[model samples]
Target: MVEQLSLLAGEREVDDTAADIADPCEESGTSVSPMLPPAPLNGLSPSLERKRLQAYLALLVGDVAILLAAFYTVSILYFGTLSNWAMLEGGMISAYVILPLYLTVALYNGTYSRRSLTEWQTSAFRAATALVIAAALVNLLAFFAKSNAEFSRMVFALGLASTAVLMTAMRIAVSRALIRKWGPTSLNKMVLLAGGPKLNLPHALHVNASEHGLEPALDDPRALDRLSKYLRNMDEVIVSCRSEDRAAWAQVLKGSGIHGEVTHQLPHEIGAIGVVHYDAAGVSALKVSSGQLGIRARVAKRLFDATVSGLVLLIAAPLMLAVALLIKLEDGGPVFFVQKRVGRGNRFFAILKFRSMRESDDNGAQSTSLEDDRVTRIGRFIRRTSIDELPQLINVLKGDMSLVGPRPHALGSKAGSKLFWEVDRNYWQRHGLRPGITGLAQVRGHRGATDTETQLSNRLLADLEYMQRWSLWQDIAILAATLRVITHERAF
Candidate 1:
């Protein structure tokens, strides 16, 4: 009888495995029919390519308009009229010389042809740099032509400043509008994930994949055949397979006639490190190194943290005192709530905040809800405006935190009734740097109580991404983004 039961269980397992690889159209809701062969795999369709070309032309035209407008506006403001044909002629000559140079520098900086448009900070930097370089070139040209004395320095300066501001603003506005209109599909890439067991990707990655038009192709006998028909629609194919199955999958991808790059996924856990080098010997070997910042970088980051936090604390001292008084008068409890939070290297630090909750015996372990009864009227207002968090500037001054890093959580914080660390092994990895009063995750809309595993996972992924891509400029961007984030409905 036991043998018969085991055989039944084995059959069920086989059926389940078969079910996992059934035609993907049924699950994905795609319009492609399973019975018909996929369309021939080829390069992008002519219509699609034409659309991209048109978009590029439109961007170029817009930029030229901005350049001409800046030049004319600056000239009018400086010389009082277009009646100054000499100054106008010089401005025209400068524009003619600088336009091509600006475009060339922008191309070199990946300003016109990069996937970073969605990030306004990167786009703004590239635009401003390109304009500055073009302005410098214009100056050089004037010197070489012995016409430097013929042009007014004020006009040149005003033109350069106006052009930079206008161009940066235009790019940011256009990029944001495109993102809102098309979501991540504006990226213009159709990625296919093929082979292996499905990856349990972080929630943030899943959202990004959806935004970027990533789709999964079931690992079935017909997957390669189905892929060939849809090749024209796909920009890239990413194969995820076990090590033993990698060669077979590669061959399958190569035979699909996709006419584009085929990439394979590495083992996620083992490949999470930044730097890796291959040693070409009898057997292939990889050496991975920790990607920690150098001593100079650490010193610079520390200096920036100290300087910015100190200035902010000084400016905010009066307001903070007023909030402290308000909190004290509300319930006569302690004005500041100092709680032990996990900081860099897993050390504990007392993070300071204006007390926003009624004094209770709960130790602040439970996550606050949107309508929690424990919140005071003053607390609600302060929390919504993020005024309660101003006291954490003290933590920043004390070196317990940075102005921008992963936010620290209280020792007993929970996600869905389970400790956050228990929810994800990688939760503690965010401690690689000092905790922050405002972080990348917070600005990206992951602030407030992490009530579920998905919330915790998304926040953790954002933190990890920030750690991997840390830069001084990125910190400044996060700080700037915090202003917008504070006005979000979820900020409370």
Candidate 2:
């Protein structure tokens, strides 16, 4: 029956007219043999499976631990180097106690996931909330235990701030590094069985698989034979369309002994509506829930951004003005530097910021670095304090940006002239919404020079996470936490 179905369904586009294969037994004076090939899967081998999992876990744990450790070391050195609480406590208590606590918090927050714990703002909010709650709880416990006097709030705050900065940075770094090393999860294991305009190759495959949270292995139906082998080996296959020849495809898939499904039913049947799935090991892991940020959510997010950015601009305006005055005095150039930036959907818009360097297009579109000579003395201080970013409130006001979204990249920014998206093709996928002032990238220490592909990739992950799952409450919370980070220069 399966062979009969395959013969009937012979290799043809799903939407094309269905072909009829006469039954072999009914043929006159002739015997017909089924021409169907053996079903093949488009998946990794067992050895490859084990290796991939091992590699993923190694990257996850090794990088996470390294980042946490670096954060711990930096915090201890910065806070303990001065003759403050460390001298009084007689040990590196800030490093010991607070470091462990922050690590615990990060772990609980799932910072180690290939996908980030949450969107940048959401993660920042969660991390900040966790730190605050943890601090309060610990302090209360210390008070009850009569040990509050043993610890200094300054040192404790320092530890938390350091952890936030370093943890965020490392998360950014690791994500970027992994993305560069392993490529975006969006470009994996989906097979495109498309027909026409309603389902073109590149986009339809992108959308259908993206909708199912499944990355198509390859888009060409000509490679379907090879893909079948891969899927059979992987034990999972996604047909990705309901065609006139759906039954034929089903037979081949069934014969291949792989679990499979149509893409249209994915949203409801699999519950993985919009959440993107990458490098999944099994059909069970293909699970994803739609993460839609609708009108109500957008309205709420915008209101939250305006309120928070407005309040923050009000409070920080004096300092921002001071920095602007200093920039003018130092270089006698424009106080606010406006540049074209790529926002949601590759839209070009002006991003406003307190100029941190001498007004010159000297380096073309390169990112500024710590040692960049163009940075003025006052610019250095303001940049470190993140005060230079204050003028972006105007951007928030103009609705060109959010108080918290993925940081915008300069117009000519590129991964070798391809733009980050063109380099990975999945880069533009993150641009589904507005960019922000302090994003997952900034808060997590990806704020400085993006000299490498890994850094941009990590930043992209954070931005995508934010767009995929965002709320007004999350925005408000990010705003508050961002205040602490800016005040302490945790995010650089």
Candidate 1 lDDT (Cα, 0 to 1) = 0.61
lDDT tens digits, residue span 1-492, model 2: 000111112332221111242321222223323443222222222212333444435544653464346444554565555456436453345345544565576556644332442233444555555566666667777779897777756656655676567545654565565445434431233343432113222211222322212222222122232333334223234454444544444433432323344434333346664432332322112221121343345557778878877887889777877777788888688888777565543344667777777755522366665577877788778777777787888889888788888787764465544455444535544545677887665566665656668877777777767665677666666666776678443322
Shift of residue 86 alpha carbon in model 1, Å: 43
Residue 279 alpha-carbon offset, candidate 1, angstroms: 19
Candidate 1, 1-492: lDDT as tens digits: 001111111122111223334333343344544433223223222213334344455666777898888878877877777687876776566777788999889867866543544566776788788888898887898889898876767767787788878877877787776566445433333323333334321110111222212232222212333343333323333433345654444444433323222232342325544322122211111221122343345557888989998898889889888888888998999988777666664444678888888854234577777888888888888899998888888888788898899898875677887777678655655765678888889988997887788899999899989888888899999999998877557744
Superposed Cα deviation of residue 29, candidate 1 (Å):
55
TM-score of each: 0.43, 0.41
Model 2 stretches with alpha carbons more than 4 Å out: 1-292, 362-364, 414-419, 487-492
Report lDDT (CA) for all predictions: 0.61, 0.51
| TM-score of candidate 2 relative to the true fold | 0.41
